[model samples]
Target: MAGGYVVGVLTETDNLNDLARGIAAGWGMKEADIPRLAQSLGQPQLQAQLAQGLQDFSDDNATDFFVIKATGTGAQTRYRAYTAIQIWPDSAFPVTRNVAGSAAAPNTLRIFSDFQCPYCKQLWDTALPEWERQPNVYRTAHYQFPLDFHKNAFSAAEASECAGAQGKFWPYADVLFDQFSSWTRLDPKDVSGRFSTYAKTAGLDTAAFKTCLGQRTFKASVEAQYKAGVALGVRGTPTVFLNGIKLMDYRSAEEQAVVQAITSATPSAASIIDARVKSLR
Candidate 1:
């Protein structure tokens, strides 16, 4: 073992244990030998082997050979490989953030998301239904990420969070993601006016939302979300955290697989989203 720790070989096979054992056996070893092999692969002693393997290659050619390939969840995998295990000391959620069900209900599963991100929309539209259907599962919280590159992103984030002040965060988020394509296609100069129209459509007080945006009431809150992302080493849109587990590597896996990874560590909670909404109301 490398430093006396077993290295897990994660795979996509449904019969993972069996596959792992078979692979080990094929190498003329026991199932338990897999971890040892992984550890050896990472040990300092293996460096000489790697160096010898590249002895005949030029510097540039050797560098090309060492380039890491995207295996599973492309961006998510890259993010996780780089940022996992690094803890953020300063990241904190809003005190009044959405709560899960009462003591009778399950704990909250807060999600930090940016409305401008297509991946965020995908998670919302696709994987969310499975968790929503699961009893005693999770409650989601939305944090704003108006990426600097997307000119209209900040306004949408501000609008959604402003709606949170009026007890309509999720509804606002839904509308923003649902109409994201249309909303973002508008001229940047027209974003504010169109956002106001969206707020009204979501049954929110358009005037209050406008005031909140004008005063930059949620600006610091928005910055805090970005800071949390930066502190956690977020480099792209749709960076999400399930409980405290940040899913930066999200490729190759389907929605159900992703959900399973998050839910694996927590017990299912009853009607998490509905309960949180009721709590907000």
Candidate 2:
């Protein structure tokens, strides 16, 4: 147990009833009397543990729970313990070769987003201004993960990719997201035409943009990006990974979380991209 946190592991066959019976046996009590013992004890910690155990058993394979407590000399000093039965999985999204900053930058922010996601637009609005101010500190790479529910999202992703081929991906994305509501609600057949207009508005060649859209030039690549995000366990848009660490609750205080993450990250002597590539060998 580290920092007052303990992870209890159970095999696939273990059930909550078995766990309760085992606890009763440890206290030299009949299994039927466990409920009375629990009430008599009246410990919040025990109650929480029992609840978590029951939940874990119901979930069937693996689950996690957290215990938080205040400690140390200062009242604000708190310790959090994360208890889990298995190691959390890591994301396998590939390193992006295309980005706004140089590969030599120490910090890298990989954003998995969808054009039609409102939360992603909110995150973009909240985080980009601050991020652009610190251009030298970190590089930003964007990946598309259009959800299946959003009928027009996949086409929008493809449109952005096509614009990217003409060196207008970021601008096209900005316009696409800015006009999300208008395009997303339109009939599916008309969404592609709207993207062509957006491309023109972003100052791209209208004819080429229309041709690209008609041909669906980047469909495979856009689908590939979405698949990569799914493989990385991305359930929603605007999932940001900083220096390879997924930032949980980033929306609570988006800019501060991003800045703090970038600031606290340990700087290495070699470029992050180079080190990552070397480790793969």
Candidate 3:
């Protein structure tokens, strides 16, 4: 078996730079004093100490040791670290719907989004297309987390769920997002009728979809997903998790960062222990 896994370390220096500048100005120091002070303080050594401290804490807590890296130059350098702690077990998220990519793909990108949210729609339109292009690597699992402020979002979520039951979740979702403005401002009572039209457009059986809609067959499922998202600390729409790790952002640059994180995540020590024990048998 491999030895202890190394976690990648990342650092952001923008805030650190600002703080350094603020401190320098407070001390009435020249601009050159900043870099000089940083070198004299042994920034690299301090970063190493911080990384070791984090590693010790993570080891004591039985969590994976992720990498720590410093970003920025000179006195503006900041240390950022990430730990791949296994919080939720695999069984915690059994609900997988609106999947895109190969069913057998090893990686799962879980998304908690509201159908009517413009940001969620933007994620779908911008990030998801590029993400979906990586079919060989991962599959996307959509979960509904409709915000309270969006009046018709919950109903739209249910409609997508019902469409999912008929094997049209993705296409139905595309239509829902594409025509978001057209339906969001409409009368609430008329939303179902519009959903039925989208169902037909998405190649779903409209009669069956209407029957499913009228019955509210998947309402419980949608509500359950929302509750699950809440339980997992999802406070808003377009919250995304790659293999259960929450992404800080899901936009253009952040999208690639997410992919890199998912692809590069080191297996936990617990998993390593389990595998070793199994092999001994």
Tell me the number of clashing residue pairs for each predicted model. 11, 0, 7
lDDT of 1 by residue, 9-99 (tens): 2222223244334334433466667776545434445434432331121122111011111232323321001101211221445444533
Q: Using TM-score as the measure, which candidate wins?
A: 3
lDDT by residue (1-281, candidate 2, tens digit) is: 21222222222212334433434443346767877654632355754543333222212222222222223323332222222322222246654434787666666777888888888888778886566567787778889889889888888888888888888888888898788779989999888878888998999998998898899888888888877876555677788766554566665566435444444435421133233223322
Q: How high is the lDDT of residue 109 in model 3?
A: 78
Question: Against the true structure, what is each candidate's TM-score?
Answer: 0.56, 0.61, 0.64
The best candidate in terms of lDDT: 3
Question: Where is model 1 more than 4 Å wrong at Cα?
Answer: 1-108, 248-281
38-59: candidate 3 lDDT, tens digit per residue: 5543566765654343332233
TM value for model 2:
0.61
Model 3: pairs clashing at backbone N, Cα or C within 3 Å: 7-66, 7-67, 8-67, 9-67, 9-68, 9-69, 11-80
Cα error, residue 30 of model 3, in Å, equals: 24
> What are the lDDT scores of the predictions, listed in order?
0.53, 0.62, 0.69
